[model samples]
Target chain A: MNIHAIKAIYRFEMARTGRTLFQSIVSPVISTSLYFVVFGAAIGSRIAEVDGVSYGAFIVPGLIMLSLLTQSVSNASFGIYFPRFTGTIYEVLSAPVSYLEIVIAYVGAAATKAIIVGLIILATAALFVPLEIQHPGWMLLFLLLTAVTFSLLGFIIGIWADNFEKLQFVPMLIITPLAFLGGSFYSISMLPPFWQKVTLFNPVVYLISGFRWSFYGQADVGVGVSLAMTLLFLGLCLAVIWWIFRTGYRLKS
Target chain B: MAPILSISDLSKTYDTGFQALKTVSLEIEKGEIFALLGPNGAGKTTLISIVCGIVNASSGTVTVDGNDIVRDYRAARSLIGLVPQELTTDAFESVWATVSFSRGLFGKPKAPEIVEKVLRDLSLWDKKDSKLVTLSGGMKRRVLIAKALAHEPRVLFLDEPTAGVDVELRRDMWRVIRELRDTGVTIILTTHYIEEAEEMADRVGVINKGEIVLVEEKAELMRKLGRKQLALHLAVPLAAVPDGLSAHNLELSDDGEELIYTYDTTGERTGITTLLQDLNATGIRFRDLQTRQSSLEEIFVNLVRTPS
Candidate 1:
């Protein structure tokens, strides 16, 4: 838990996240521009505004969160998975550095990359479509909290995965589709009441809702509910990662 | 002085129900090159792995410099560095960075000069900037050694350190090992190469089928357990051996050109002269004679061939 150890581990891990910087900086910018073209100009003409703001402006926060979640998970998973693949986990397990130091270092680096990507998407969204933040401070807080929560979730995925395919399988197939269905591109209120209730069960809805609330002063869910859900998710992820480290799961064996 | 490492009745049963180690016990002095010899399925690597704390012991205890390995893991691990059988290193990392990072992993403050010296000692300074994937197999092996030595461990374990390398690299590795030993480091090596143990070890322990069959001083072990062979060049090619020469217990070469006699050197009386005279009385004569000693490999084979 010493700062020196954390610095070394963190430095090494961040240096290894090549795809994070590439995907984080490029994916969001590209995806946000495309979303502006397809959903803003093409689709916006067909549908009316949802919450007093333009439809293009409505999807900005959700698009940013999309990139944030995927980049966060991919960065953290690859960071831990490479060591296991290369047999360097033996070196880590045998080292004097504690498990908490390792968790903090990796999760922190992933969060840093995720946050940077989030900011870039937010800035890029302005170039294509005009966007404004109603609660700037809460927006920053929500962005940071979501990044940390997803980064920790990625750490758990990294530890549990044995192969490269398995690493991508969960994030790409499960998490992304769930987030998309949770109303990243459209509002869930447009669906039947049964589906609306079901959307509430999706953890990503709270993250997207919280991020959307940051901009335009409008939110589908209560601001308190979204913040509380994010904090709860972050706590759950930290608990899982801590338990894995404590039991030395997949690490010692 | 107390022994540097002690293990009491250590055993390990893997999850698959394969017993890798069976109630093994030994004490290694602080500055000796102890070689553990065994065939492919033996418990040599298992024992070393347990001591290095990579694998847990099913039962029994291990202590390094008076610290229990399980109870004082960090202290004990910091005292030992293991060069694994596999040639694993950071494929993209420069040799200098890899070795220095290994030192940092042990919680040691950065010491670039010492790291440089260790690299230079291993003849890797020239390749310090080269990526590990660019290095040859032998060079990669040396990198593994440099990384293990970066922390300056008190006890170093080389587990089959030279498995597939060529003769030149193997010799160079031995040279470095000797230099390390001279500096008062305890070395415990596991190898299937009997010649390696014969050339370098101060003492040898043979493990077979999850058991330590024998442990003894190299010279004394050879002297006490080894057999000598006497071969006689025949004066004339014999169609068959005479019945009277049977008491000498001689074996005829397949070509019928030589007679082979085997005896124990440790015996007070070899009876070679008596056998020669008896052969002469039986109308046999030899143009020349030769004697040979059994090698460590032969003795190793004999030891493993014995029943439990």
Candidate 2:
């Protein structure tokens, strides 16, 4: 209910993103752009297209999702973790702000940053690949939902991580590999029977597939199921965060 | 008038089973400087942390202006401004922005004039545009105080506001604190400096072993506990005290050069006249005599050493 509090926290975080411009926005866009060049040259020559889209265009949605997931998680996680590291979190915890408002401000700012990065990558991708949007509304929805979900996950990681080394553990050891194997580069349908079945178990596959379906109208799974899975993950993150505040875990102590 | 803040049976037992507080209770008047004095690991910080809601209380009830700190936390917290012991602030943000942002965190509407006034009062108006990382340690401490005052709370808790600063900065901080107190803000500070309490606090609370050992008006406590010592220099060294002076509380110096007598400042008759007459009658002559009163530091040490 404290609107000013939320704005203060939100604006402060957003200002930090602006301050670390290269690390926050430019690096992810540039790295995703490099993916476009290397994959377009190396893989585009061998395969003409995956489904009806060109090989170059096929990875655009997937690459954007890759950066979105990573940046959202890292941004929200570091946003909270740095405060804890410096012992400045006591300021926010003692303020008039509630736990839900704290979560909303941090996660919302992080998602906003991730969404902007996703849009910029989309624009950058257009310079190389001939892309088409089948459903712009659904694409926006997918982008917003994925950023919020991953940012919430990052918020949890921030609280659970006690040290700087542990802060980078999940993004490096778990998320990157999942993004690579989640059909971000090549469609899971192109793999053999057993490998395709194995790829389906990776949760990232559902996110990317649902997102890509809104682009080319073709996907590895039904759009409805992918949306449901994302909501389920979002709910799970919410439950964990609610428990964190209720029990005063890591934050209150 | 009701106390601005009231705490009853407050306690905190950490997960590790360490009992940090044991049924501690306190009340703060609306416009007075109160000091909590204790040594390290004496739970001064823990007690403040619980009242500020940074640490959960194991069992207690706290009301700030009739607002329960736990049940109506938002309302209660809005009235409090805490300058914590640790130096923690956003190094990236400018002084003006951070202080302004802190005000908003208390749900107060934007008032640039108030922010400007707080900055000027803290002697930080010149550094308003400077980032915190660029500021000196003393300046950062000032900024922390400015941030705490940004909300204009009725009660302010300064937890060791002058811990590591130099003498000049400590004096400056004390002046700022006194100025705040003059504006009718109830100031509660925790410190290990007996001098600080003697110089500023109207009431002093000595906390030790997770309990308040003593709380009394500074003057009253000093009068009641303060003792005066009289030392007499003997013209001729004596191996033992004179038999006539046996009734007087006296101690012989090991070097056999002086006699010491201790007396209470609050006692109407210190018996000094009779003791000196008895010494003269016993053929004891003194070249010089000096009287000294015990300081708050000695009183604090004695209080902490004894079981409450």
Candidate 3:
């Protein structure tokens, strides 16, 4: 199982986060808090509630999902990509660790970091809005599933990217915009019927809707559909990761 | 005892169609220093990369202590350590942390004592806490060695271990390598410095253009191909060598003041006594004479310079 190798890689990555606490944890936490102040408090006070939930509270799950998606992708991508860029990947490649263990170590650490940041954002959100969890168990499941799934996507991106610009390309140009338009600051139902249909194409919507359903128990799509959709996306990411390891993709030549 | 490492018919052709290695084969004893000497682009690095599992080989197989490198990679790799050519490291990591991390990566249990010993042996103990980015190039090279040794592998492959380092660090590195050898760890190194091979190698292998030209014990290689030259300074200038010395194939100096005779050192008869007698009979008076033996560098150059 090479458990020691996994632990070594995981601890090394976690230590890197500790060393760069400001960029890794504090920066994202502060940014999400600002989003709460500007959008939830300042702006929500002027708008009516959606789905019987207050506007500020309505965006909690969406905001948390937003942070989870971006942070997971960035963290996981950079975790693997930095070694490749610095030429230190030779150590990892030559080690007795298998491909599965490498994926587990890198993706697990990234998910852990994303989950920590999500929790911190949730705590900060409490100060801005009255929050409640109708199904705490479901909420935790959604959090873990979302964190792990996006982290896997990030792992694929890390292997696929050849340059720093390409590394940032997917997370910044693709993920952030999808999360914003998917449902972060508002419900997809608020959009016109046609645009609401189009918004379904954005995979982030399924994650946000599934996560929000666990909180207030009212979601735009049926909760069952949201769960299925999340799992489907998770399955897709897993398949891609398996293919990467099988083919050695950009990780080996 | 069985060889610690064996390579048979290994070949590598990169994606770009560059054939880096071609049917290479070699073996290493359990506790000897084997030096692979070659010039740039001679497949030294490619061969080491394949054995270390960093680069996949195009054909053939390698085994470490009877564990097939591909089929049983974990067991095979666990027995080997590689100090790569480049000084690549995590810039933000401390020396102690990185070395410990390497040990753990090899699936070894945490042994701080072993890590400390490796660091101290490489003269990196005092700087263990310093970030890698802050260390000098020589210190970073030492840290690389410390990382390779952290796991206590049975065999160590050093790819250009002394390249670009200062003389003092090079000497320290040699001392550390010798100490490792004394501990019964098999050592294989590839080097551009023939003197490094001459100074440390028990057996030397010369590679050129993706082929192994020769592999022999250092002493035997030097003797087999080595040529000795005898130069005689004549008391008077002469236009050419004496007719009596033509059988000896002697060369006259451009200024005609000295004569040079070349002979194989490994030959049963150097004919020095007979040459001296013939010189005296021919009245070829000489003021002084000196003999020189060719160095390993000359032999290596001759080995690689010719077509395979």
Predicted model with the maximum DockQ:
3
lDDT of 3 by residue, A15-48 (tens): 9999999998899888988887887889888989
Query: Can you give the lDDT of residue B129 in candidate 1?
Result: 95
lDDT of 1 by residue, B209-298 (tens): 999999999999999888999999998987777898888788999889899999999988998989988987988888999999999999
Candidate 1 off by > 4 Å: A2-5, A18-28, A40-47, A131-137, A246-248, B239-241
DockQ of each two-chain model: 0.44, 0.84, 0.87
For each candidate, the alpha-carbon lDDT, in order, equals 0.86, 0.92, 0.91
lDDT of model 3 at residue B252? 92
Alpha-carbon shift of residue B279 in model 2 (angstroms):
2.6
- Residue B104, model 3: lDDT of 93
Q: Write the per-residue lDDT of candidate 2 for residues A1-253, one digit (tens) a residue.
A: 9999999999999999999999998999889878877897666768777897899999999999999999999999999999999988888988999888999999999999999999999999999889999999999999999999999999999999999888899999998899999999889988999999998888999999999999999999999999999999999999999999999889886
TM-score of each: 0.91, 0.97, 0.98
Model 2 Cα shift for residue A125 (angstroms) = 0.4
Over B38-149, each residue of candidate 3 has an lDDT whose tens digit, in order, gives: 9999999999888888888999899999999989999999998899899999999999999999999999999999999999888899999999999999999899989998
What docking grade does candidate 3 earn?
high
Cα RMSD to the true fold for all candidates: 2.7, 1.5, 1.3
Q: Give the winner by lDDT.
A: 2
- Best candidate, TM-score: 3
The local lDDT score (0 to 100) that residue B289 gets in candidate 3 is 97
